[model samples]
Target chain A: MSGNENREKYKLNVGKIYEGFVIDHIHAGRGMKLYKDLGLEKLDCSVAIITNASSKKMGKKDIIKVECPIDRFDLETIGFMDHTATVDVIKDGEIINKPKLSLPKTVKNIIKCKNPRCITSIEQGLDHIFVLTDPEKEVYRCKYCETKYGEQ
Target chain B: MRHLLTPLDLSVEELETLMDNAEKIKADPEKYAHVCDGKIIATLFYEPSTRTRLSFEAAMLRLGGKTMGFATADSSSAAKGESVADTIRIISCFADIAAMRHPKEGSATVAAKHSRIPVINAGDGGHQHPTQTLTDMMTIRALKGHFDGMTIGLCGDLKFGRTVHSLIRALLRYKDVRFILISPDELKLPDYMTDEIKRNGAEYEEITKLEDAMPRLDILYMTRVQRERFFNEEDYVRLKDYYILDMPKMELAKEDMIVLHPLPRVNEIAVEVDEDPRAKYFEQVQYGMYIRMALICMLLDISL
Candidate 1:
């Protein structure tokens, strides 16, 4: 009914962690992907993903709550996925910091280079890295082949 | 520690120095014959480019250095699924420097990252070929005497032509260099390249017809439609003969206009055009050796 009510509803859905991160305002349907990209599943800690959550800023959004330390958390993955997403640092049952996320200058082992002709495609055990070449255009090119991401 | 993965690896001043070194080597090659006497060069060509391979080998041999390596991917450890990183690391142990050509774009960069020695990119798949650009620049400087205020016409296969891309990038550093990009509609320069040209405030005109841009050109660069770059044989066949540089096209060019091609030309330049004094593609090949010789010396820190 109200902004506070919506916030309360989300808080009720996922319990607050003692020490971890709460990635909020993720674009709708990207929470699971962010979870996978961050490799949260591989972690031994409890992780909660909320999809299609109502947002005042964004019409709908996704949120991820990780019940673990922030040391292993990948902020670059979150930044590359959704720069608008707010990362809330939790400590002792309280939000200590709300760090702003922006597109990473370089992302490693996140988005894979799709260019078949790229060395990363054939080489085994190589990190798939992309560099933000054009910040204005938000263009990411494969560090190996220079092939722009999503290019045919 | 210095690797030539692209022409931009060297600054404008460094390029000028390298060019001067190349010119010196060209003038008196015998004087610097023993510059690389104890050096060893590993030519790791993971692609079949006989011209580039020979040019590198010749450059090394002329510098009194020994050359060793496989010519094709099948003949190398790459055929056994060995990564470029591993091959280059191994090559670094045996050779003082390495020149590598691979079918995959940015393969040289990967090799360079793992190499303990200097890595020279001979040619990568439809990507930047710095050595070829060096050769082109050397030829232009020798023939035209300067890079500024030159209207260079680049004809055919601009999209997949690595030399065209590299040459454009290298020439864009100069003042008042206009580019007449002559290529078919489907094979025009890539949008990213055009964007770079515009971003650098370089003047360029894209035209489909070669003759239309010929007469006003100071340098006419012809490129073969690379069959290897094409995914389909039908597309390759259709574009292969799009813009042939012949006597008719040469007739339209300016008298002082020098023609350059990164060779292994396949019907792109007719035999008739080869007789013209303006056709300096063969001289381009010779410059390729000289520039490479200069490049090896620069990379190896060998001063003569």
Candidate 2:
């Protein structure tokens, strides 16, 4: 395939792999790194963007943008960036989604309240429901486990 | 219906007004259940405080109002780097009144700075917890018959207990009340507080031993020596069990002397003490809910 073909190869449909947080690659022409998770130690790249993912996980629905070397990464690794962005992408013109992700009265994580005595954080077989009490502050609680809300 | 951000907001008359309403609620809770109907009290707990948050929410609910807010940090927009002002500003539009707790000193006051609705400070990071003071006031009035001429003992974590400081400030409003401070030297009352004690002409005495001070005490209020407040875990480990009260300790007091605690106790009092007629902490907690209920009812101007 031609070099232009290589550029469009991983274009937009890049699988949800290859560190979805990868938003840019400013080739510095030196040694770089990859897969900080399993300790890839090092790789070759100019500059890479890592994310402080506020949303907890990465998904295609959250993809702010992705910039890359085109051939070096795979789909799954790229999917992790689904919810984050690189400053370069915005400078290069990528719009951030205005609608913030929220914990709508339902949740997925097991309750982890420090109060072991708290009912919802302990009792089994109950749905963990937490309304978006404050969107600016990401907080949640088990509805059944914490009954103060119900009493209200 | 302004924010109860500090004890200063509760003038002696307003404080008595709240106390009278709370006492009325205690006497007949059902009558006031319909007081705050159709109103909402958004309890924005920026910090996790099961008891304080519950007290306020229970108050609103019992008064026929509703509540909606988070119980922890991860559950708030603070996780998203949202400012306190932004959060309270939004919650105020939804609630007729709100109560909040934050780890930072003056955070509730900061929230009050922007809130259009009445804001209550349930507790703010070792700073102010005025409702607990009101709870203490209502409790003292109910159990001891009057706040005047009473000898009040505040035991444990006195140096760092916001509730203790708030209670002392509130007690000053009463006549001839003498304070007996009991705690480890590492946790002695704050000098600023002692200054207030002196300035108000309220008499006080500091004691390291609870049993030593028990005989003369009219009200013995216990507070936990928080593990986090100690710079040395060894100090807390060495001192917590040392200050605990058992059934034997009650013998040193007047038969009708009341015992109060900010609940969620970690063995500060023996479980067996729960049976004693003098052990009023549970009822105190219940009264707390009613007092908060009455306050919310009056603050929001709802009809019972």
Candidate 2 lDDT over A107-134, as tens digits, reads 3332333433233332333234444333
Candidate lDDT values, in order: 0.91, 0.68
RMSD of each: 2.2, 15.6
Model 2 DockQ class: incorrect
Q: Which tens-of-lDDT digit does each residue in A1-152 have in candidate 1?
A: 99988778666476668999999998999899889888998999999888998788899999998999878777788899888889999889898888778899999988899877788888878899999989999999988778888885
Per-candidate TM-scores read 0.95, 0.65
Candidate 2 residue-wise lDDT at B59: 82
Clashes of each: 0, 36
Calculate model 2's interface RMSD in Å: 13.7
lDDT of 2 by residue, B1-304 (tens): 5778777677988777777887788788888777777888888886778888988888878888888999987999888877777888899888889888877555675677788999988877666688888888888887777889999999988976889988998888889999999988878986657867988999999988888988998999999877755667888898877688888889899997999998779989999988999999988888788778867866776533
Model 1 lDDT tens row, B1-304: 7999999999999999999999999999999998999899999988888888899999999999999999899999989999988999899889999999998888888988899999999988888899999999999999999999999999999998999999999999999999999999999998878988999999999999888998899999999998888889999999999988889888988899999999889898999998999999999999999999999999999885
- Candidate that would win on lDDT: 1
Best by TM-score: 1
The segments of candidate 2 whose C-alpha lies over 4 angstroms from its true place after superposition are A1-152, B302-304
